[model samples]
Target: MTYSGDVTPGGAPAVRELSGLTVSKLSVGPMDNNAYLLTCRSTGDQVLIDAANEAPRLLELIGGDGLDAVITTHRHMDHWVALEEVVAKTGARALVHADDAEGLPIPAETLTEGDTVPVGDCALEVIHLRGHTPGSIALLYRDPAGTPHLFTGDSLFPGGVGNTDKDPERFAALIDDVERKLFGRLPDDTWFYPGHGKDSTLGAERPALPQWRARGW
Candidate 1:
């Protein structure tokens, strides 16, 4: 089936396709945060990104498919409330950043910048993007056809950016990182899947960087 739209309750965005890897978006929590499901076509292996608050719904989505791992973008409760339950239901290993790995309900395999995580025949590179949280990360992956994909949690958004009000220095750093690391290097065609709002391309967001910067983060 072709993947599109929010598949979970509360208008969460999700996209799945049998052709390549499938990506499902789940809306969780009072804030309506987005969680993702990435499935490998070659091996039917899957990885869950940010469990949110809908454990039962996430489990149903994983039905029959072998869940290999769960990745948390950061330590925020809105992003990880259901992480333990999903791990228990799918028997999948958890992957998180070392900075925020502690205090999680489940054991997790810590990931750092420059690390590559494999699922089936595909691999996702971990990019440390602090600001929204000390351990926030963006997962970058390339499809078989060389299409670049970036799963940016609260770190980035279309037209807008992640909330960094928790710390001024951290927020400033995050803005700088987004400008240099993400917007500067990545191709315009790169697909940006954010933690909230609709999806957009790097090309689309490039023009808006100045505005975001002008706002002073």
Candidate 2:
């Protein structure tokens, strides 16, 4: 499919095919959180990112293919409302950043920056972006034949970074981490999927960084 990244609650997911894996983006819940299901092409092994809501739908989306892990991008309740039920049903390994692990109702394996999450024959590298609840992470998948693809959970979006509650310190920390850890390291062509709404490439959002910073959101 085209992978427009525009998804709505109760709508069909948008699918993106890469060299080694497939990314299926589904929106669930009243909050419109985005849940990503990645399947390894070689092994059909899959991992879900953010089981945000609607346990039955998530389980249905997963189908009989089964799941290997469910990776929560952060501790935000809106981001993991369906986590426990989904994990219980699939027996998938539950994972979250150590800083936000305690916030989850279910116990999860703690992750840190530089951690590698396995998916069948593929792997996703973790990039910790703080200030969006202390343990927000973005997953990076470097396509062997293409550019890097990022799964940014609430830490970044098309117009700006995640909310910092108007706290200058937190805002600064978030902006700094986003700039240094994300924009600086990845190429402009890198396509990123956010927690909600449409996806965008670094090139599309690069010019607005200063604006986002100046506004201090």
Candidate 3:
């Protein structure tokens, strides 16, 4: 039942406990995209975020039991490159924002802001973040102990917000959502898992909010 500290040979990172849920992260593809697997221990229901790359490794993680669904954070090619293969192998439902749904190789059910994605007994509240992609969304889960776990797909990261163009409007919108919907509302202790790289806490990234805004991405 214990997970390794580093990514296992199968490419799955150490399993971490977030409240009642078990989270397994994987780094795949040439882009090093991050894929997350959330399994509800109580119900054995599991969902995956970003079927990026390495179908064989991902399929190994899903195991014979398969997955309940796969949620695509955005329509970027790097994030969903393995979508077709994973879905074909597991028969897991695919979910993406309506705006970005067309970008996928196959049609995916749309999930918008305010919607709740059920993973067994746990629920992930969706938050639509703009700029990086119009349909880019983040998932928020508040543990019983009151800690917030955020899955911000390419929208927010450790150093700063997701890459935005010189377009002031786009940068402004992205920072606005990150500051208000995310930093403004969540506690400093909130844990944010992004589409790539190591996980970060709101507390770790809070003080730099002004800098991120002033510099403009």
User: Best TM-score goes to which candidate?
Assistant: 2
Worst 10 residues of 1 by lDDT: 1-10
* lDDT to native, each model: 0.81, 0.93, 0.88
Q: Residue 196's C-alpha lDDT in candidate 1?
A: 66
Candidate number with the higher lDDT (2 or 3): 2
* Model 2 residue 110 distance off true place after TM-score fit, in angstroms: 0.3
Using alpha carbons, what is the TM-score of model 3? Answer: 0.94
If ranked by lDDT, best first, what sequence of candidates would result?
A: 2, 3, 1
Model 2, 52-167: lDDT tens per residue? 99988888888899999999999989989999999888899999999999999999999999999999888999999989889899999989889999999999999999998999
Q: By lDDT, is 1 or 2 better?
A: 2
Off by over 4 Å in 2: none
In candidate 3, stretches whose alpha carbon ends up further than 4 angstroms from where it belongs are 1-12
Candidate 1 lDDT (Cα, 0 to 1): 0.81
